[model samples]
Target: ILAALSFFATGSTQTNLGDNFVLGLSQAMTSRSIKEVTDSMTEHLASRHIRFPNTANEINRIKEGFFLKHRIRGVVGCIDCTHVPILAPAEADEDHPPIVYYNRKGYYSLNVQLVNLLVNMKILAANSQSPSSVHDSAIWAASIIRTNVERTFRKGNNIWLMGALLHICRNAQPGTPEARYTLRHSQTRNVIEKCNGLLKMRFRCLSKQLLYHPIRVGKIIYAAVVLHNLAIDFNLNDLNDEEPLIIDNDENVPNIHNNHDVLNEGSRVRANFIRRYF
Candidate 1:
């Protein structure tokens, strides 16, 4: 199973896998069967390996890591979205049209959201269920991680995931606190780009167009994420020297237009952060 999974992650076709393995295996295994295996592996591995910090100690460790590495405090993770190219869905029906999978990039894809612990480049949350047509902000608003973060905040926990803040420092003087904060924030948030790039480089399947059902493609993505974390655990270094892709932020600034309270709170937080750190 591991061998098959390794081959899958490395972007081997089913025919190639069959040629390498036994005939009985060939007769039993189809693309759908492989997807089934991948799904099972993803679920099992994610349950065991991918987890958000729930305890104070675990949360503090993550915060400490961010502070030590990026000179930024209270950042538990970095969040961003990456598009995984896929073939247009053949199974599209009236309710789920094929055009829905077409992204702004001129291709069919899944807009996958990832929240990674910048300190270790380990993914804390991954959401591959949204189609390419979905906006990143909508995906974020609908994410379970966002819900959990809100709940945690209500309970008096004040941690946050780092996102792009370049807009805030726009046109500001170079030596100003806003400019300095933006510089650090960009440096810190860049880890997610590296993580996404390393993940695709490590798992060749992600870098290429996945020729599978849209649902199966999502499962494969999850499996790749699990394997990526496992590779990090094992200290594997099979990635190439290619530059990691920088994921473009659909919306860099937080949306505070709808709620004055949110705008005020964010302003207060930024002011406090700049005053104390920048």
Candidate 2:
């Protein structure tokens, strides 16, 4: 720490504290054993007095509280995916499935999907810790809070729950109030995309091809999230003055016949298998 800081103080860029700190944070957080770093991070967070939701109950409350008051169109939250690059041990394929094609490393990953609802442009709920292979839509369907949203929509007839994702996104069953709502409100709900960009940009380690052991990679990913949540808690990196861009989207996308469509269409027998499986 002293070495890096001294170099920075001397205005030396080749081997400065800023570079060392970035390397240290990445190596310690993302590429080291999480069990070791989480303890230190926990202690650090304790000193800072920063708190993040550690359970599903707290997450649910945040969601309910946000939507209960906001009267925004077809939007409850913004949904998107981010990849945490992980190590690819040659032996991993023996236990794991085939290759994950979409990752930066094209080796392995813990695909984290973050869903956040912003109230007054502040993050309300931030969901994380999903497997790399999980689908964006499936995460929404499996969300504990979303089931309640569906039930509420069903009772109030406030909007129809003809299908799941559309209702959550506020896209209606074609020409419905919810459909118009989804298109109109999607502009306000795009904060997650921006958040992803800022996070990747701020932490260049995440933007790079991760070269670390798998176990260490998991810890690094969690540590980054914990640090991010802490920043949000303290308003450290919060950007409220910047006016967010809003787009006008009127086009509606169609949902499948049922929840099984992603798997069924890829193969002839697989399609039949999905019909029976669902």
Candidate 3:
């Protein structure tokens, strides 16, 4: 609702919808929890004769998924780092120091690099909390994709390269056993990148310093994502195609029983969101 209002309320570029929405949302939050505030805002927008998505669930799916085509399952949105300045941390703790960051924080202002994935553009898998120094490859390596699989297998601590099916396959030579296996496993993961681009374009607040507290900055991000859903739900834009790059079939990928039915704790697969997350 804030996004919708911001875009329509002003003709001037001084107040970006992404930034203003966050400001308004943070103010609204002064009287309510995030969820409560959002519910109230939905009602308020309706009363003001402006329409917004009726629910957060709908907002996440229809608005962001269809409108923006942010196709990472359980991801709400994706964003890479844009630079920032920050006051240095007051401690010598190595974990908190600015190593890879630019010398602005004396220390450094860390940008949270993430792709907020959505499963069927509904359920949000929160962004991974990692340091700014972490690159995309590193982030993907540390992702729940690997961790969850390891946990399921009751594996140990080391990151096994052979287990990185996608990477191993991409590096393999043609017609060889392991090469054939690696080539088969490699997946084209680009939809999420496109989502990142759209997000930066739509939410300018994320591209620059918010000049607000870190908490407020976070609100700014959330508000933009919420508003993104609103625009998509309203048909301001259309969904993009999200298909993984499929190399030659290796026949080594996990095979599960087709005879039995499985669900995500919900008792259904396709019904989980009615759309496949690429």
Best by lDDT: 1
Tell me the tens digit of each residue's lDDT in model 3 across 91-193: 5646555365433334344444433332222112223233345444455555664454345335432111111122332344566654433332232134333
lDDT of 2 by residue, 1-278 (tens): 33322221232333233356544544333223334555565446443432333335654555565556544323345545566555454555564443542443344665655444454233323344444556556666676656655665556423211122333322247765445455544543454455665555434445554454454444444455555556666668543357343221212222444646643542343233223322
Tens-digit lDDT track for model 1 on 122-231?
Answer: 88888887888886677888888888888887888778777642235557688899889888877766666777877777777887788777788888888888877887
TM-score of 2: 0.52
Q: Could you give me the TM-score of model 3 versus the true structure?
A: 0.39
Backbone collision count in every prediction? 0, 7, 17
Report the lDDT of model 1 for residue 275.
Answer: 81
lDDT of all the models against the reference?
0.75, 0.44, 0.37
- Give candidate 1 regions above 4 Å deviation: 21-33, 165-168, 240-272
Worst ten in a row by lDDT for model 1: 246-255
Which ranges of candidate 3 are over 4 A from the true structure? 1-109, 113-123, 128-170, 175-187, 238-278
Q: What is the C-alpha RMSD of each candidate to the true structure, in Å?
A: 3.5, 9.7, 13.5
**Best candidate according to TM-score:** 1
